[model samples]
Target: MLLPSLYFEEGFKVIGNMVNTAFGKFNLTGKTALITGAAGLLGQQHASALLEIGATVVLTDISAEALGAACTALSCESTASRILTRVMDVSRAESITTVAEEFSDRRIDILVNNAAIDPKVNGDAGIQETSRLENFPLVQWELQLAVGLTGAFLCSQVFGSAMASDGRGGVILNIASDLSVFSPDQRLYRKEGLPADLQPVKPVTYSVIKAGLVGLTRYLATYWAEQGVRANALSPGGVFNGQGDEFVTRLTSLIPLGRMAKADEYQSVVQFLCTDASAYLNGQNIVMDGGRSVW
Candidate 1:
């Protein structure tokens, strides 16, 4: 029995529409996402991903010069109008509160707590003392916690409350690390011939800050579950950032995938967590470590 051509075309068109509708769950049209540390390498990538998905990205960093440069760079990929830049010092409550008030009129649907000090992976002699516990300065550890952990807490409290109060609800994506769940393999930071005591190791503060973010994720997830706000953490693996061949090879060997992550690799996961695609995901630390942690 031959169906009418018009009927067949209409049925196929309906199916196509359904698929597009489903795919649209990942779209962030009309939503605004505020990403801290937006001038940094990973922060820029996160902003790009969100902007590509039609989200209005408010890129905030402590350095005005870097933030301006990043916003300019990102403008090449997107319209200047869609990209908003702010000099936000996440370490201070006053800074967070000021930015929060400025954006209070806007409904910020997503917050990516991506600010943190990059651990000095390269064992330079000038900075060698900071990485080891015995010589790790108290001021450095306290400062790391202030920025990485305390910053997240303050942003969640202020921006998150705005989301709840507005009745729109939202998502908070904490940028954690694979170290959040597991201790850093100190061997990766070791130099070949150095004595064990004198060799550089991953700092104690890095793991503590990351682990705290994971704990914060779980707490916020449940704390605001009834208010329609969801919190989740993303624990990404080491990215290929022009490290020495020895470092890259040593790190990749430990991973089942046998390679460091490309810069753009984690963008899709950011899109997922920030959009409706991850509507039910909450309180979970999604580890995208290229199978490193498993091994």
Candidate 2:
């Protein structure tokens, strides 16, 4: 009833090959990665990692010096050949539009939206009460959201349009944080008597802004699916090394992994989501919190 022995063996080999190819590695040889907040700790790691894996990386930051530094570091030896640098203020739509025009006819294969600010709420508290987000200070909440949220949206709208119209779909990875959830012990301000939302254990603006990204990503994912674009968020755990000692200690204790995450640990997930490997995953917030959410 079955096939001959040789045929069975050949069938087995074919199945194995198919499986391997399906789960095998992917390279980004002809792609370009556009990274905002591209000079910060995580940003550099993402840029360097992508470049190492063959993607040409376009790095942008609020500081001209920061962008220069990133380019210099990447271009210094072998890696330098793969980076392009820009100074951008994500808070300004005009700044984004300018860059968009400069890149007029190009397509950005991947976009990492990871810009942010650690603004104080009060004397040290991070959130200033807005009458209804209506009477909010012209500078604080609006400014923070503009950089963290609007900037991401602008990039998606501008760069995404170009990427799709090229008749090629692309990846958009939004860098969110565990603070997008109830960040009890992961505050970011130095002030006391802060609103429950803006405490040092979990900064108000950081949480609110990231939470908004969930919606932005979902909307874009749905909006662009037919166009071959994918959108998703990565909610990384509290990272160690960059933060102050006090904050780091508190965050470490809260982790089920019994330690804070190092920046390098996030590279694989980002690489997967940013490449063809995650081609079908969209509108999802993949948390990398070491099972903290589980506990």
Candidate 3:
């Protein structure tokens, strides 16, 4: 059926406005984003996403060598000038403070708390034995929490405070995991013929750190709402990072998508959370886990 000319004109205006607003919100030209653990796989991907939208990205990691390599890998003629690297230990307040001071002259419009000590559960018999909850080391527990949970808190406190004090408003994106909302299926890590005591399991620290991030996200979302700083978390599922075939098969069977996520799959959502595209979104955990949590 043909529409009236007047209706057509009004519809066209509404459609045009929506298109313009959508594109405008995603644009990050002149904004600056700082990412902790910037040398890691997901960290580099987050930096790439923000940089693609014209944001200046500050990549921070504890290892200068690793950060250097990441910078070299991400550098291209078009975005070379937009990429900056800093050696920072998230577990240390002074380290985070130093970086904040160095960038004091510029507005940090976005903060991506992507740092974490994710203990890989390779099926090495020795590793499996040590990873058991009963055998888990206290030193390892402290280190993981220090880097993952406390580090996010400290970064939010320093840079988040700066964003609030500036009164210009900012965004905080906490990198969580699908395990945040659910317990790990330890069966995925089971080794054939391994006795119960020798079986490898997902470390306890991973869950606690991620769950803590979600809680922190909620707290900060309300704590700084009036200050114009928004906080949110992204909980991603397992990524296909060269895990053994047996483990991959078992894990993928649990996901409806029948596959693990690619390293770059979460980039777009990272962009959305860090940009005005998600302006009204706050204090929520977005799980992108191939529908695994539902199962």
Candidate 4:
């Protein structure tokens, strides 16, 4: 015999509530995520990932014009309410502090440290010579570290401290590079007839900064574990931006997948790392290098 009408209604409601709760673990509704360098290519993708999962995003960059353009690009009728933009120079403590204070009334549940100086190497003889490790300028090295490494530290210190004390906990994701785990294959950047002294090499600071981020990830992971905050690093491989076919072929040959990642390929992984979907994942560097690092 069938259950009474009231009993069936109650049972169906209970099952629906349970389903919602289970799926809600991946939902980030009402949470706010602040992304540094949000005007850059990967930064925009990271913001999109969080927005797709229902988090309000604060897009910050050093250039107000670029930040405004990025904000406008991401804004739509549906997502307009969820997007905010701020000008933040991650290298300066005061800039970070100012933004932190501006949003003091709201809780920031996630922080994506995606700022870095990635100097592109081209066939230009002058650029190639200056990029040589021996000739690399002191000023360039310092500036790179200030943005890539020290910036992550300062953001974590200010925003992460707040996350720890707020009692709600949070996520801090450091956007590192596959170079963090492996040295750059300098051969991929060698020009056909470049002299030994003129061959372009990836700057030493890139590897150092990326590696440092992973170290910071481990420190913060445990530093705030008791406080409920989690920290992790994402080590992404090269994306397929328009580059010389020769360079692309050389780079892809090293990868087991034989192809570079699309610009948007990392979005789902970003969502996972920044949401409850990765609740048990902390102190880890998740490398997405298309098997190149392993090979």
lDDT of each: 0.91, 0.78, 0.93, 0.93
Better of 1 and 4 by TM-score: 1
TM-score, candidate 1, is 0.93
Say which candidate scores most in TM-score. 3
lDDT of 1 by residue, 164-219 (tens): 77667899999999999899888888887666667888899999999999999999
Q: Candidate 4: where are CA atoms >4 Å away? A: 1-22
RMSD values for the candidates in order, in angstroms, are: 2.3, 4.6, 1.7, 4.0
Mark the regions of model 1 whose C-alpha exceeds 4 Å error after superposition. 1-15, 125-128
lDDT of 3 by residue, 28-59 (tens): 99999999999999999999899888999999
Report clashes for each candidate as comma-separated counts. Answer: 0, 13, 0, 0
Two-way TM-score contest, 2 vs 4, winner: 4
Q: Write the per-residue lDDT of candidate 4 for residues 113-206, one digit (tens) a residue.
A: 9999998987467644878889999999999999999999999999999999978899999999999999988998898777888888888999
Each prediction's TM-score versus the true structure: 0.93, 0.82, 0.95, 0.92
RMSD of 4: 4.0
Candidate achieving higher lDDT, 2 or 3: 3
Answer with 1 or 2, whichever has the higher TM-score: 1
Evaluated at residue 4, the lDDT of candidate 4 is 94
Consecutive 10-residue window with the lowest summed lDDT within model 1: 121-130
Which is better, 2 or 3, measured by TM-score? 3
